[model samples]
Target: MSGGVDSAVAAARAVEAGHEVVGVHLALSRMPGTLRTGSRGCCTIEDSMDARRAAAKLGIPFYVWDFSERFRADVVDDFVAEYAAGRTPNPCMRCNERIKFAALLDKALALGFDAVVTGHYAEVRQGPDGVELHRAAAWAKDQSYVLGVLTAEQLAHSWFPLGATPSKAEVRAEAEARGLSVAAKPDSHDICFIPDGDTRGWLASRVGAEEGAILDRSGERIGTHPGAAAFTVGQRKGLNIGYPSPDGRPRFVLEVRPKTNEVVVGPKEALAISELAGARFSWAGAAPADAASGFDCEVQVRAHADPVPATARLEDGELVIRVEEPIEGVAPGQTAVVYVGTRVVGQCTIDRTVSAVPASR
Candidate 1:
């Protein structure tokens, strides 16, 4: 529990369900923690104290385990490198993949705990076939998309006590009815590592500024950008360029060229993509037989984005997804999570893309 209303309510529900429960607050940083009043970032000192208070209220043994080094290396460093490699990265998914499931789960198992529980609003059910991941009862807060990277082993040992709950409002009401002190606390939504939500500035500071030239489709210098790390594939604002296209058309980022220290921009259509490839593949409950074995699935290339119809196949132990409905501005270094109904089938880190071309071209 993070000392927040949702987690507090989750713990309470677990207790009500007559299961043995333990509360763990991850001490992800040695630096001062974040504010419950400030932007919705996690791991602040006040937040930790809040969590401890909630755990105390529940009469459960709560402990804070430090995972600073692991978080920095797995989530932070990976975020920087992904941007430097000209791909947009989702740090939340990275944390969920490496920290929550891998690091924290490993620790829980080593300590003899049968399972670990979190406040994520997603559901798990045991059907005739087997355990399955499902969309939370709350569609608005559904997090199964980000969690699609979990292996079947991890899913089996994990519990999302708040998964079936419908909303933050409902959770808060439960907390209040139960008289938990954290009933009024808000949710944390920003990337925990980039506290201020200024991802470009944070990334530039960590990776060092490398000024770059902005180019058009033909590789002609169109403008200058502050740094290659400061931009993403679909960004339209903050270009800071004064020139207009010869056709007097608006522009959008076409690509980031880290090797050449360049930002590529052009007409909006330049951003459309049809196919994506990913590595570091993780499947929920099954494995693909071969490259020819295709499964109909919904693929999410970005968090909170609408699911796009896609078909996935295995190639060299990687997932290659062909989006049936072409998606615009798909970014590499982000996760491509595949789902069959509510169950997460698999996920991978996008490595390459194929764009849509105009028929006239």
Candidate 2:
């Protein structure tokens, strides 16, 4: 439990189902103050306390597992490195992929635990071949996109007690009825490691800010940026360009080059991307038999972004995705979660992209 309503309710349901349950809250931060308060970030001292109280109410054993070092190495350092390489990465996805499922699940299995149960809003179903991951019943509260990283083995040993719940409101209500104190606790947001919500400021301190040139689509230098690593593709607020576009349109960040310390800005239309591909990939449960022959699917990049119709196939040891419509502001380092109907089939960390708009145009 994150000392939140969802996880507390999830644990309550697990215990209610007549299974022996243990409430394990991960201590992910060595320095707790770095975790912000007031609905911004999680893993705080207050959150742990809340979790312990909920466990006491549920009459289960509660323990705080120290995963600080592993979390820092896998999620925190990876975030810094990805930003320094000028790629926008989702640290939550990395946490789910590396720490939560891989490291945590591995440890749980070694301890003879059947599965690592959590409060994620996703479903696990027994398929004909094996267990498969699917979206929650409600699309609005579905989180299968992040859980898309789970392999067949991981899915087999995972449980989401609240997956079939209708809505978050109902979870909160259940928590309240169960006498759980965290029934109304605000959901966490932003990067947990960053105390404040200012990501660019936090990155500048670690990556070491240095001035860099901001160029337009036609290779025209328009302005300078405080740091190349601080900007991400699709960002529009902080460009600080001196002049406006000829058509008086707002320009978005098209690219960031950390090697040369350059930020590329262009009209929003140039952000349209036709294709994305990645070398690092994994399937949810079963690999598509026709993956080499190309198969129809849907791709989602962000946590809440709508899925787009696409075709996926393996080519030269990479997962290549071709979307039916143009995707805007797609950059390298984002994970593309592919779906066939409601089930999560596979995912890939995007390594490259092909733009729909020509450079000169």
The sequence of per-residue lDDT tens digits that candidate 2 reaches over residues 178-287 is: 99988888888888888878898999999989998999988889999999999989999988997898889998999999999999999898999999999999999989
How many residue pairs clash in each candidate at the backbone level? 4, 0
The estimated TM-scores of all candidates read 0.94, 0.98
Candidate 1: count of backbone clashes, pairs at least 3 residues apart or interchain: 4
Off by over 4 Å in 1: 33-39, 127-129, 288-291, 358-361
CA lDDT of each prediction against the hidden true structure = 0.81, 0.91
Candidates in order: C-alpha RMSD to true structure: 2.1, 0.9
- Candidate 1 lDDT tens digits, 13-70: 8888888788888877776543223527777777778888888888888888898899
Q: What is the lDDT of residue 106 in candidate 2?
A: 94
Off by over 4 Å in 2: none
Deviation of model 2 at 194, angstroms: 0.4
lDDT of 2 at 322: 98
